[model samples]
Target chain A: GAGVSQSPSNKVTEKGKDVELRCDPISGHTALYWYRQRLGQGLEFLIYFQGNSAPDKSGLPSDRFSAERTGESVSTLTIQRTQQEDSAVYLCASSLAATVVRSSYNEQFFGPGTRLTVL
Target chain B: GIQVEQSPPDLILQEGANSTLRCNFSDSVNNLQWFHQNPWGQLINLFYIPSGTKQNGRLSATTVATERYSLLYISSSQTTDSGVYFCAVDQETSGSRLTFGEGTQLTVNP
Candidate 1:
């Protein structure tokens, strides 16, 4: 089975530029999540989507960060006017379901991650 | 938000040895998982134990949700086992959002 996949394994952009990272979750997965991992640091929750419900944007660091998922398949995280502080590895993950009852047992499959560098 | 912490931020071990990694959380959680971030930057799911103990080959994990802690044990460590180990949890208040620990950087030398 195909695991979650992310595009632009490596991205280099100048400060103030905008970038979009893509994610392809495993087929049939109803939940998708985005996270950021700074060098030698832990994963920081960004946003999540479950089926067709409204996405969870509470974790978005600021207005410059936003993510969208269409039909529970592909997701894109966009960072507008990126700053050097935004440099990090963007990771995507997915689960079978994310309802309150089933979420406790869902195992998230992660993508290889996209390393974004802001110079 | 629940606070998660992993002890011994870094560890160095010799091949064929054994080691234990610990994770502690500040509150109750409905889900607890262990992951290994390989040298190539791929996150691999190792365990999905919210409670009880499970073993896979030389690796095993035990999560005591009641105590808000978990332990991962590796026996006969191999050079390929060198990587960052992370513990993440989904608190009752956070639905499926996983709060991750700083991770334990492990280095296994042959």
Candidate 2:
């Protein structure tokens, strides 16, 4: 694909229902990241996947939030028992490799983002 | 945790005018980047500048690693340039997780 892509550009769900967001990263990119943007605010890091393993999941808001990557391709972020506070735009990005550790920092290319609204 | 702060939270400019946005980080970072979020909420990479300066067309950016600040300059702005500008960084202490600023909302009028 030319760039990172995400599914279900807009999703509306009830407060207690669970929701899942999917991300398809750029081909051959081994590192993927997830972020969340609330209304009138900058994005907040949710998790980072270096290949299939997530080295950093510190930003996950709570136990309700979790993500998994399939090898180096697709990734899914699941919000279990969503709340009104979970409403936000979920963004996915991919890079050639981990930044800083690599000899050259790889720029992360982001997807169109999934706007999740919990009623 | 490193905190990112962006100045001029809101900006209004006439088309063909110029503007400058500023970003300051609380700690050292291994990488820094500037991104433009369009009205559609898609993030566009503008510059991957951790240090030094880079120019592309009417947009230019400069980062002073030692001073812990970065500046983005947009010359001859257009209505299409109106949107939100964000500054993000990766620090070794945080496993290089990208932390973003609150962003500056820019409005360019014709």
Q: Best candidate per TM-score, number?
A: 2
**Model 1 per-residue lDDT tens digits across residues B7-50:** 88999999999999999999988788999999999999999888
Per-candidate alpha-carbon RMSD to the true structure:
1.3, 1.1
Which 10 consecutive positions of candidate 1 chain A have the poorest summed lDDT?
A97-106
- Give lDDT tens digits, candidate 1, residues A27-111: 9988899999999999999988897564577889999998888886898999999999999999999998765552443788899
Docking class of 2: medium
Residue A119 lDDT in model 1?
99
Best by DockQ: 1
Model 2 CA deviation exceeding 4 Å by range? A101-104
Name the Cα RMSD for model 1: 1.3
Error of 2 at A17 (Å): 1.0
Per-residue error (Å), model 1, residue B55: 0.6
lDDT of each: 0.91, 0.93
